[model samples]
Target: MGKSQKQRAIRRHNPMRVPDTHLPKGLASASSSSSKNEAVLPIIQKMESPEVGERKWACVAVSNIIQNDPSTRRLLQGKNVVGALIARLTDSEEEVVVEAMGSLRNLCIDGGYDICAEMYNKNILTPLKAFVPKISTTLEQYLANPKAAPENAAKLVYEFADNVITTLWCLSETSNKALNAINALQLVPFLMSFLACRDRLPLAPVTAAAQCLYVLSDDNEPAIDEVRSNGEFITSLLAIARTVSDARTSHGKVDIRRLQLGVLASGVLKNISPLPLAVASDIDIDKELVTMLLPVLQNTSLRDATARVPVLLSEQANEVAVDKPSLKNTPKSDHRSPVEIELESIENQLRTTQLALEILTAACATLPDPDVSKHDEEADEQEDEGMEEEEIDEGVNDEMSVEGVPSKDEVKSSVDLLPSLVPVLIQLAEPTALSFPPLANPSIHPPTTSALGAVHIAALECLNNIFLSLARNPSSTVQADTVAAKGIWDGLWKSLGLVGTEFGLGQERRKQFWELAIGVLWGVSMVWKGFLAPDAQEVELLKLFCNSSEDERVRVKCIGTLECLAQCPTAVDGNKIIAEYLFTLLPTDTTPPAGVEPAIQAGSALIDIYSDETFPYDVNFRANGYLERLVAHVDAMKKLVKGIDRRKPGGRELRLRGEEVRDNLVAFLKYRKALKL
Candidate 1:
């Protein structure tokens, strides 16, 4: 009985035993093999079949195999496959035709423009068009679902559109069908309809549409006008764009809604301009829509991104205006109520408001100058040079003489309200910061995101405009004073250490701040080239920025400013000034302020300048020891991390440090190696 049980256990557990060929275990494995064979058998079996349905399936199977299987797909080129697929499009069997079309689509998928171009050249596009209704039907099915993958659909549509658009262009370029290419133009309606559907206009379509619009808009006579008229054909395109541009979607996404608004703006502007060839007897846009749209173009947000020129066809009024003070603030009257300590809440809010007002006042010192000079130049140039002297003498020119192009005071007053608008832009930044508990309650700190970054951007822009205005000054009387430039430098310095880690910041905000800081400093560096001439206080401020334990971006800015300083014509010993302390705070081997990649790039840019290859030795000039030491330190650090493993957290920190160190070391070593001594 023990032996029998042992034998049973052995039979049940036969883990290493090989099965007999004819046994059920082997038979099951054989069945799997047989099924795979059957799955593949049909493809090859039908390849040369006389049956129409069989032939179509063969074309599809080969196409699918070529598309899905790497080995088979390689066989699709420069051969009978394209010809065979094209011929099968004429097959009577529907399945055959569909499969053939599907295979051709697959070939075109990977083939890109060359194959599409080839197909168009071969007049193979005629059959391709026949398949569009089928493709569009499929596209519509995908679009109907609320959860449709908009991106995937866009790619497919772009592919189809590319083939069609290119084909149409080629056809149009020739003597063939300059006007009537029904096959190509019909697809335009499908694309336009997709724009309305919301699921159709993904990033790819936005890109494709830009390209497609340019292609379709290119006509010789009234070309711009012809493009504007397209809006008339499909008015809903503008409507969809408007809807998308205005939408903010969930928190933190780019207001694609704003983008669509710009497209609408562009389309509208196109319609207004050189296009339509005739000024409308009456324009469709009312004054209010004009008011709403003009601000968008005027907004600093769109100006930098779109570079739209906000032409004042006529001077438009500000939408939300601060009314002129009706009466001056009078000394408290005897009738005034007693002090209201009970309303502490009101007092705190008032204090907060006053603080914001002060910041804006300080920020305004940075804004760019207005275009007064250009206006003045035009005003001076238009003097009766063209008119006959006798005719000019006979005419009463008093009515035609414009009141001296708006005074500087008038321009300043018109834009003075900009400081007031700073708060609203700050309010937009507050929710993102979460540092300040919103603007409703009184707080010591302003909203960090809005006040720090947004204000910085606005300040930079205003400074740019101010500089531009100064550049345009007709009179040598107005110049960029050190006081104004100093105020800007001080303001930027105060904000320097405040911009912390970049992880929580938006890319646009970060970019804006960096750009503003770099630009302003570059300008300031130019203005104060010889730091030698600045007052004692300005020199002290420079010293603090270089040596202080401030924020990293600020340090980065200082380094950048120092680099710019190096370029200034008036800079005396600029290299000596920067070389003294820059290496201490912004060591190339360390993780930079915010520890962001861009900060690292900025550091690398500085180190590159220190290399001897960059600054080859000229014995006549003093040797730059500071640059030499910086290179040496980077080298020692690089050698220490060379053999260390870096997959773990400790390793990662090492790698970050190691990367900076390595770049610095390599740069330094390269210079050191190049030294003759």
Candidate 2:
């Protein structure tokens, strides 16, 4: 009796130990060597008990087991472990609830389908939903009286909000059930509210809410539709995207939280509207939202930082003072941190660039495709001519008017962001050095190579979209101004120079570079034809790129650019250079041209030149002898097409293209004859 009484007294004094009388059958047999599954059941049973001390002990035990032993996760799912944890969400004891949330979160980290599905079936989110109002109340209280609020108010609010959001984020990974639950609970607006209160709230919950929204809306149309339907939610998200904190460290660096918030806001925007115009259709976003994003797309801070050149004399002196022999033994320097930060800046900039591009792409989608519109207009005219006068009048009435379409002014306002965007592209397209300290071992902290092919590709696509938008809305005076700006043209020319120089760039990037270059040329010609003439260097680069074997798309684009240049009244010398180049591709009266594709492309370009009534026809005809060379090239194309066998690969298509060129040439000759030229 004395020994047993002494042992019981000792156990009663030990706060960390659960008395054997309190242990369930599962725990009573648990030992140090026992598997966690065998140990979790009894602890889970105590977690559901009414006694506060037992519940607290059980919660702590379960958290440790689940956090430390990965295998216990599936074992805990065997019974009503998740259901019990969910029920504990509103426990009067905050510590118990926190432990439960942590364990639940851990379970979800690798909690396979069966575990999550079981939790979903048990309606785990019901108790979680009850905490939302608590978060809202805390946020409202803080907003009303920030100075008077309890010290733990912000902490409590963030914990509750983050736990819920994280649990949902985890659950959403397994199925759409979590998302469905979120929608049913109307949690989207709450999450939006948290993000809106970001100025006062901690970033952890704000980011958690953002991430939850990102996951919930991604590829989930119903969620996206819901997000879109909420005007306030959309407004709040855009505000977050635009908000920039003024906080900076002693080093003068902006807080990383600001960058993260911007990125998350971008992710949310991408998930919700993805297509900017679709969003614009329902809301007046063209001005406000686009204005917010344009600055990000044009961010040249990374470029500015890397482009900073040290004074030449100082650099030379520093190089001379460095001891080369001791470099190998020198420890790695802290200078690499700035390079790392620069890379981070580049990453953030890329994210912003991508978001801006998505917005632009969406805006572009709302407008008509220029080529498709032209084809449609031609088809309509033919159909109208075939109808009787009364029928034609009726048809005109039935035809949709372009009046409701977004005006060129609106389109221009959006695409005019291109001028700001082009310099960023040129900056990113060129490589920059990431040098370590001279004394540091080069092998240890070797210069960081800036591989921005993805950035380059995105920039190219953004440029293409801008060009496309401009082409579709030729009446946009704003875009015309953007195009005619010296900055825009200078950026384009500099980018063209960077085409083949991006280190570690892949073939796709090269193709993208050419596509962007050619697209800019064509866009300029289409909108402000003959207004800007190519300089001799520009013309020569086009010729070189046009003749390149690097990519067929590049060559084709080069030819198109040359044609555009030739049509400019200010570029008669360019026209002559182009004419001579095309002449060289002609069959020398004996053999066909080496490359059938280039020949066809050259012939097509010449046809475009001859058909350009806007060009100074007398100068082309007299000074350049363009008419004579064009006729000769057309004759050579006819011979080349005839020489190719129709049965070979691409032979038939090549011949067809050649015949089309011949027809265009013949039409131009007839026009020339009619004018007695």
lDDT by candidate, in order shown = 0.40, 0.57
Best by TM-score: 2
> For candidate 1, lDDT tens digit of each residue in 199-309?
444443443333234233333223344445565433454354345335445774434334433343333333333334343334333222333333332332312211111
Provide the RMSD of all predictions against the true structure, rounded to 1 decimal.
27.0, 17.6
Instruction: Kindly report which residue pairs in candidate 2 clash with one another.
Output: none
Off by over 4 Å in 2: 1-223, 229-235, 244-253, 263-267, 270-283, 297-299, 307-350, 353-366, 369-406, 414-431, 434-457, 475-485, 498-511, 549-552, 582-604, 612-666
Of candidate 2, the 10-residue stretch with the lowest lDDT total is 1-10
lDDT of 2: 0.57
lDDT for each residue of candidate 2 in 363-433, tens digit (9 for 90 to 100): 44445421223444554456444643234233333333222345757676745665565556555544333
